[model samples]
Target: MPTKQEILDLHFMDARYKLIDLAAFLDRVDRHSGEGDFRFDALKAALPLLLSEQQGRAKAVLDALSDPSIEPIEKATTQGASGAPRPAGVPL
Candidate 1:
């Protein structure tokens, strides 16, 4: 389960995705036409939401990491459990 902070972070990330999408759209509009009023209006409307998401995003991330449900994975070793040396030229 995601903690309170984790949930917040996830939401922020999702909002960031929206911001990126809008920005890209605006860029395209600009490249194609100087009078791209619609794109600008859309971006302006999205600004507040994006800002709010970014503001609380960091705290949300910390909360997520604190959750016990999350697990840490370790990379496997080339050698066996006994720590025996591997043959030369073996790829990791």
Candidate 2:
């Protein structure tokens, strides 16, 4: 088993762009949202695609962020419509 710091550094510290790549995404979300509701909502939204194969890791990361001691603030931005909705600038 990897040490916690190793797991964290490998999964979160060097991640880029995508939330699934980062272990801390949930923690950040929890710290920024002021509620677990939003964090779990975001996780449920993302899980089908990003965490399907790594559900345990995803759950662990999310659970860690659920601590009441964490703060929450609204995220500065959100992704455009998911599924078939293409982001701006990409030809449909």
Candidate 3:
């Protein structure tokens, strides 16, 4: 099993790859499509929001890992009264 830091590192690297892939994909689409294409416009508009969300998630994970008071992620899950598993720090 990977340690917490290792897991967080993998998450960060994966996020970076995803952002790069999105940019490359968009570039390819832009090159193939003509101006005023709805798909290009839509993708261009959404990229920033997607980047922001990924950044936010990365920051949150980093913060959780860095803060000593925060519980370890491995211990941050439990079965509720309904016998359903749920994550800690997240409310259903």
Candidate 4:
């Protein structure tokens, strides 16, 4: 396994860019005029996980955005997943 310092040295810039990209994305969201979006809500809800000391952040984040429903809908309205849990009118 690589030392912590070695790992950071090799990946810090890539991580830095990702963080900046996330910030910029949020900024663009803020500049737009619109009601709340579930995707953004999911992203915001998962932000705290990045600061968490515990492991499983990735899984936790995925769970946050994933639909909790065990039952399948009669049919999907869209061809793609919304990337956020629960439909707008549906309760989790």
| Candidate 3, superposed: residue stretches over 4 Å from native | 1-7, 51-92
Worst lDDT window (10 residues) for model 3? Answer: 80-89
Best by TM-score: 4
Better of 2 and 3 by lDDT: 3
Q: What lDDT, from 0 to 1, does candidate 1 have?
A: 0.51
Poorest stretch of ten by lDDT in candidate 4: 83-92
Instruction: Please write out the lDDT profile of model 2 over residues 1-92, one tens digit for every residue.
Output: 99988887887744554645455766676578455544355455555554456557755555444433344435625554322222235342
**Model 2 steric clash total:** 7
Q: Would you give me the overall lDDT of model 3?
A: 0.52
Between candidates 1 and 3, the one scoring higher on lDDT is 3
RMSD of candidate 1 to the truth, in angstroms, is: 17.8
lDDT string, candidate 1, 1-92, tens digits? 88999888779888789769968976777688456343245335445553464677545444433323334327655443222222335333
- List, residue by residue over 27-51, the lDDT tens digit for candidate 3: 7766774564433444454444544
Query: What are the lDDT scores of the predictions, listed in order?
Result: 0.51, 0.51, 0.52, 0.86
Candidate 2: deviation at residue 40, Å? 6.9
Candidate 2 C-alpha RMSD relative to the actual structure: 14.5
RMSD of each: 17.8, 14.5, 14.5, 2.2
